[model samples]
Target: MASCKQVESMIQAWIDGELGDSERVILDQHFQECPLCTITLRKQQRCAALLFEGFADHRLRHSIRQRVMENLPEMEPLRVDLEGVNWRGHDTKPKRAWLGPLMRMAAVFILICLASLLYSAWPKGEKNFDGAVGMITQTEGAAFRETGHGLFCRSVALKDFVKFGAFYKTGPNSHLMVSLRGPTQLRIDENTRFQICDDRKIRVETGRVALDVSRDERKFRVLTPSGTITVYGTVFEVSVDSVQTLVTLQSGALQVESAGAQGELKPGEQTCFTRGQNAITTRTVDTAQVLGWTKAIMPDSEAYDRFAREVQPLKIAELPGEQVFAVITTKNGKPRAVSSFCLAWNPATDGEERCGYDVHVYNEAMHELFSVHVDGSVFANPNRRSHEIDAPGAPIVNAGVLHVKIVPDNSAGKQTPLKVSAVGL
Candidate 1:
């Protein structure tokens, strides 16, 4: 059965008889069972009737007969033939000779009248509605090219209209955002330059852009020096530099075509196109990490430390120190019920580098929701000396507090010091 909200939303379409049969059935059943909905439907019908009644007084002021006759083809004069006619075996001259002329006049008048009525019923000129294809909705530290005037010092203004061939450039710390009628949302990354080729295409001169495109009949294309990324309703990011263009899919799917080679990308997958390479290279990626900057979140040591202190240990012989790197929460301060997590782990010594740790996550009721095993290499890294672990399946609940416990494997003795930090994605 359709919910009350769904039925209410389609009430206008229902009254217009524009809904599909299945949808109409759902709304009908809901209205029958719900008296409030029934009353609302009746009121809507009454209001529609009253509104249409106002148009009944409208009248056409022009003469229909003249307009109709002017649009019709020229008619020849009518002629009557009596060559073979005979009456009672004798040639007969018609007594009603004037009847032919009168009939012709009547036929002309009736034809013109009929043509006038039909013309009057036909629709008038339809007005074309010109809507924008895209607009710059937000910007920070970004600038736009003025074609012969050079670059402007400021970013594009809110709701600034975007036209074909327009160029946008962003600084190292800049972000340029755009929205299109396709409901396609875009965030241009820092040090990037791109052109609006048209509504269906964009050209990336350099840098990157994260896109959240809704399903559209026409595919959206991002062109780079190396290749083109074709999207049909997907959340993805594309980056291009002098060497290569990287396409990452956070959700949905897309196709990458370059130099007579092609490949498809799925969620959590990414592919790269090199300038001179014939075959495209594809690999797995942590989508949250790759697209986090588009969401305005970056790797912050302060945030990492804050989340690290919230780590708790479970029943293990020893616990390496654990840290919370990030908390993936919304503006409302509620942790996403299902999201990714970035965990950083540091081992105390190389001897215990290969150890495994069991991670437990619980809801507010202290009920275990799920657990993940952290491989030892997660605590090993050459640069940071700490491995960044991408844990994607964390089940958070409405109550919002995550009770996480980390326990080391039996290979480790008591009093093991493991440094770990985690961030929600």
Candidate 2:
């Protein structure tokens, strides 16, 4: 009979249907008698099921779906003809005779156009200027170039190529996240410079980069700030913080060593080192947290700015008793002279009683730009209305510092002051 620890180790494999027959027999016999092992196996099975369910849900995010689709070149549509008529037993019309070939030609042309569009849309490759570099592609955008000194932010589309680089910085903040399309290998050299040579070998100079390697057969390696990292296929995160270096294996297995103190790290295992030290300590770390850099979300400034810009009111002035106002401001902070003004108004009491008012806008120089009128009337009662004003473009040239004045209706006596106040954008 196996010990409890040994049984527990094999239980997950058994539930997953991954154990060999001999291992299965041993587990089955033990489960029949050991209530603890049986319960443990059942619990593990449930956990596996839940984990898979969560994974399925996560795969639905747009980023994951886009990546999956990009990798599946086989899904590209094939061209085919649909207009061919069968002539096995009967005669076909002359128009039908040419239809099959015509359709085929059309399909070919469409396929060629589609392929060209997709190729143009693919992500552009990046050249590493320093420590290291890699290439990434999608169906859009030009190739991107990236260099690593410390931590860097990249567009999600650039993440697929796993191209990254790092250089020695005396300060503490040197880190970078290199996106990967598949499992990648990187090498760091002590005071050296190198590039990701294909997807198999990583050339490095005297700096190190943390790697979040995927599970694909793509070879992953790193030239370190001090030495080299050779890895078997696995998912792991590696980092070199100054004189110290660390490698954390989240899944599968990996080998790490510096100055000949070598250690094999299994899933959930991590190793750390300092220069000239042979001591290697193995500890457990959360794999997801360590590799979180690979999947980190970047902040979007443009979208945030757009929202902020649209929410604020433009700097136009409103009439005192009116519900709405018109504003004018320069693109920057500068102000210009307003030489003319026009207002078309609506009467609150009746639609037919509306009238127009002509107002002149002038600059400090007393130059006239153009003029128009407000087409509504104001009585003692508050009447809400709006009007459009047209002016020559010349007066608004220097955008900042412009002033507007409303000319009262001569028929209503100058006593009626157009209630007005200025607002800033």
Candidate 3:
């Protein structure tokens, strides 16, 4: 069954007769079972009826028929033959018989001409929406150029595509961050210039960026003026200027390739590669001062207090084989409410065995409510999808753990382990 929130979005389409037959059947079935949705549907229908009535009361003060007809393409004259025997059993010619047919032909011709114009006005730049591998989750005073070769630029906005081969830059004190499909989070600091080459490759021209990249089989690469930095999954910052390129690692490990040599940086380490120099500079550094600006990217703790669980990153199925989270529930006086916002995971390697599992939800009585079956093949990261607990007029009846279980599918025992993070709303 669809969530109440999702069904509400479809209600307007249902009223407009835009829904397909299959969807109509599903909506009808839901209305029969969900009284709350049924009431909402009735309210929406009333609003639509009122709006339609209001439209009926109004008319255009002026007519465009003359202007349109003047520019319309010429049509062949209507040919009507009133040669059949008269219905009145007399040979009286029908009065102005061609006039009715001519009028109908004119109406149809006008509609056809107008439809052609309407279609012509639609944007032809729809191809720009293709090849998107990431989305801008946050932006401030940033500008984006859809194509690297174009001088045209537009102000960046949240949820805008981080399209492949596109250029993005930020002004002083401005910030931009993209949630790549690889589930990597890249925060571009102000005065930065960069372009995304692909899902895992970016070329930096100048300024700095902080990356909290998720682990994957493929390595993420950042190309700078001095060299290229490569790593599987790491938290780090990279800055480039006219003189040299600087890199700092907060967690995990990264390798900088420059001057025909490879250098590695451990946690709390910083390295600088000077332009045209074979020597690489290295030093221990403070992570807070260099990347403290990224702290703004974290969700506010106080604001998320209502959430029963924050984002919990789990490294599942390495050595332990399996893990389960459970807590006994004791019924309280109130009903239970359940809602989750985003759930993401690094998918199994392409064409590799995928781990499968069941995420089960329960009520205060420990009754199974719903289950989300997860696998790497169809289920992977940057998940903005939401799931809501179906409890009619309900709140949490018990003060126990909100999530109930995660049972591994034993049948697919050879499946690869998956890294997952889930958050409650």
Candidate 4:
């Protein structure tokens, strides 16, 4: 019914059930009588059964093809003779039997890469806080908690959740620090009691707190006795006394509202709210003065030597080559005020002073509150004290830590250092 050549070509299709009824009938009739073709058909059936059993996952096959198509660049389509030994080569086996094994091996590697890609693209679930908002990251001294039952002092570990309306207080010499899921850090200072409203809001009933907020779109807020502040990704300090509330922005920005009036603050700005009508004021402040709590503990001599070398070439003849006459006035052992450390090498001739010192005065917070440049030729009396010199716009002495840095000026000269101690004011 069918020729040997036709039987050879149609055997695979017949085994796969892809032959039409007439073609199948002809193939069946030929196979019943032809021993050679019957053996070939049996081999084809075995091969098909093995392939289907080995790679039966339909989705896996689809994924492999999809991944290869999507990730690789476009290429020309390739056609292979089903009966050939190999692609593009007549040397392929009689039925191209190597194709199935080659594709199977390739599928293994592709599946690994595709699995990795899919896993990476998958979304991570939302962060869990249980029911509370934040946890205590660090604590020093005794911290107390007020609950519906009663007030109790307890030992807590890091990562203990702080819930809404929970009142937390610190004993003397005690401090508490909190970290939140939003990546916010709050340092609760000594003798402080505050109630948490939410993850981003706090009410300070008393004492002080420092906030270091990471850059984020979410807004943080603080409520004080006399005013409120809305925080926006910045470092700042807030102090609430019985009579007033003080806010200092070391970096970033905030909005202050008090006494029915509102004001905006940028970096190096401060605002004060007193408990009275029309008692709100905002102004530029010295960052070091307000943030004096973070002062570096460098000695006066080291500070002077450091600045001296930094302003080198201009020498102070009154002191050692590496030393400058830098005096720090303190209140209760904290730097409270500073005297102008003057250097007199650049002569003031023709109504211009060339060589001298640029003095920066900082408070205990290590904030440069103000600066003054003492004219080198202006201080005629070497015996005159620093305060006697009438330097314009000199900073007033205040109660707090004081730090001074003097930078030598030889701008009028070839900008070289004068290796001498010119004079001290």
lDDT of 4 at 423: 20
Each candidate's number of clashing pairs is: 14, 54, 5, 26
- lDDT score of residue 88 within candidate 2: 32
lDDT of every model, 2 decimals:
0.63, 0.48, 0.64, 0.60
The top-ranked prediction according to TM-score is 3
Q: Write the per-residue lDDT of candidate 1 for residues 1-425, one digit (tens) a residue.
A: 55566568779888998766656766787888999888989999999999888776774556599889899899964332212111233344576788889999999999999998666444232121233356565667645544433533333554455656777788778787766555567788889888887666889989999888765435578999998787656899999999889899999767776775666687999898876566666899999999888777232343223222221111112233432111223324334544544444343554434556676655444566677876655554333444444444444435343445566666543323443333444
What TM value does model 1 have? 0.39
User: Model 3 off-target regions past 4 Å?
Assistant: 1-130, 146-150, 298-425
Candidate 3 vs. true structure, TM-score = 0.42
- What TM-score would candidate 2 get against the native? 0.29
Predicted candidate 4 versus true structure: per-residue lDDT over 90-172, tens digit per residue: 45475778898999999999999999866544423223244556666566677766654444344443445667777888778
> TM-score for each prediction?
0.39, 0.29, 0.42, 0.38
lDDT of residue 252 for candidate 4:
70
* Worst 10 contiguous positions by lDDT, candidate 3: 306-315
